[model samples]
Target: MSKDYYKVLGVEKTATADEIKRAFLKLAHQYHPDKNGGKDDKFKEINEAYQVLGNAEKRKQFDQFGANFNGAGGFGGGQGYGGFGGFQNGGMNINMDDLGDLGEMFGGLGDIFGFGSARGGQGRRREPQRGSDIEAAMTIDFLEAVFGAEKEVTLKKKITCAHCGGTGAEPGAKIEECPTCKGHGRVRRVQQTILGSIQTEASCPSCGGEGKIASKKCSECNGAGTAYDTAKFKVRIPAGVDDGGRIRIPGYGEAGDRGAGVGDLYLNIRVRPSDKFARDEYDILTKKEISFTQAALGDKIEIETVHGKVELKIPEGTQSGTVFKLKNKGVPHTSGRNIGDHLIEVVVKTPKNLNKRQKESLKELGI
Candidate 1:
């Protein structure tokens, strides 16, 4: 009897490829045998369903003739779907592109199943490899964070050697073809597996995928092809960038091997706290000390804001924690579209030390 893969994965027959994949991952996580209470048989069943429905061509055949169409018997003897036959002859061909980073879900079973991870195949030559990313931290003043500033940061890192120009060879050395891969930059090996003899290609270890090697090594860098050097980068800090914000400087990371694509530099921003102002997202908060008489009399006073000093009116009978808003006096947005407001929290100061005349006057007024 044909098994309904859609029912097994808890999906409709009309489910899209992405929908099928999502269902498979969810069930795979639950039934994975490595878990504390994993169902090995259920995991295998889910994998089988995904193998058919996850693939476009296989799904088409399965939809037309039922899931049993691709079974060992096949649909009325139409070559038996050749499902594991390819594995029996050549090897199992797994598409690493579709797997993406989801291969991590398999975890300990990665080696057993030969899953290509984020680094892809171990032996395959990484054509145009991406460089390694570098992380750094920068501390800026509160006002600088509110307004934006450009600052330079220096770092000591590996750079291409000036002597050999990253070739790792002497100026006049003889370059020979890689003997390991025969100038192909890759070597193929056949391994016996449960499926059959699987052929795999890996980068040439001798030449490091360059297909060539130098007879004499570079003297200055000692054949490392790189040297320790200092580099300075000017980074632009955006306005209203909060603490722990990251700034990415593209192509400023470590140099790639043999002129491959350069990686990026990530700058973690650390904003220092202001003595007079506190920020809440885009809004600026400040505290103003007012005399008790001023709160009762309603007087105009000057308050310092990020933009400048502005006059704020204290209303009559104001409470101790009265709050006032100053429109457009806060930080300007990084997008330059809108600005935030400045909020002032009033703290009234009460007279504690009283002279004889002041106490007598207050007593008279109260009476």
Candidate 2:
């Protein structure tokens, strides 16, 4: 069935160019192949879908062609328009002048698909690729999050075997072309349907889609070219990085087979709760308790800041819930801005127990 491009991009068909760009960017960031695990095909599909729908002229042609537009064939296969088999096979005979700006769009898709003009020849496949990215969660102390700290984390991941150099073969061993797909890495299955013969291509199961078979497999990786290793690394928590913020550590994730670059590691941060202070942007909030006598008769009180103890004066008759702001005494801003203010809320504490003599003295003063 023909996929709906607008639906793929999560936008209406009548969406404007700006709206289409915004929607594409959001979804692209969400499902980018480098970030989203187990969704690489979906990411590629949406990117291709948006490439055609984001443009006006291509959209018009696509709307005109309806379901007959063969994205795999790079458009112009007219099973919808007046029986004009559209362009010739291999998309070679299509008139470049008619495609207009779509040439660039197709060119970009070709880069991803490794089309004829790409480094690989027609139907030529590239090397085995990197593994998908993985996400992990880490918790740090609030003070560490504010001041930035380095931590060592250990995770079990697959890494290319050092014994065989990721080729999955014994030392100095040769690789032979796969017998299943005959070095194609993919095999076509033709289904005889009511309309005609429909061919579908699937990865070759025998060679695992690599199109090459190792003569002797490496004992460590068992021919998969990767092994499980306990990866340990130091992760730097940047100052002022808030909770739920992500830190991307590239090339520290799972290793790829056949010397492919390692996948990326994503750390989802969680800040531990602070007992004495609360964070608000770059500001810190705290509570201070004072005696009723101190509030009634103004006095100097000592309070604790992240820095140290500081003396603050309380005015006479100071009410409860009064907030005092201390400038440049809060968390540091990541952008190098001035330190935020410290907000201290004062609460007057009443005496809970009094001796008989104290009670008598109070009664003599009041009664």
Residue 90 CA displacement from its true place in model 2, Å: 8.1
TM-score for each of the candidates: 0.69, 0.55
lDDT of 2 by residue, 31-84 (tens): 655452526667666666666676576778778877776563345335332222
Report the lDDT tens digits of candidate 1 across residue range 99-212.
434546544434433433223446543343456889998999999999999999898766677898877688899999877678997666565644255455556555777888
How much RMSD separates candidate 2 from the native structure? 11.1
Which pairs of residues collide in candidate 2? none
Model 1 ranges off by over 4 Å: 1-70, 73-90, 95-129, 163-189, 193-225, 334-337, 351-364
Superposed Cα deviation of residue 336, candidate 1 (Å): 4.5
Error of 2 at 16 (Å): 22
Off by over 4 Å in 2: 1-126, 167-169, 174-217, 335-338, 351-367
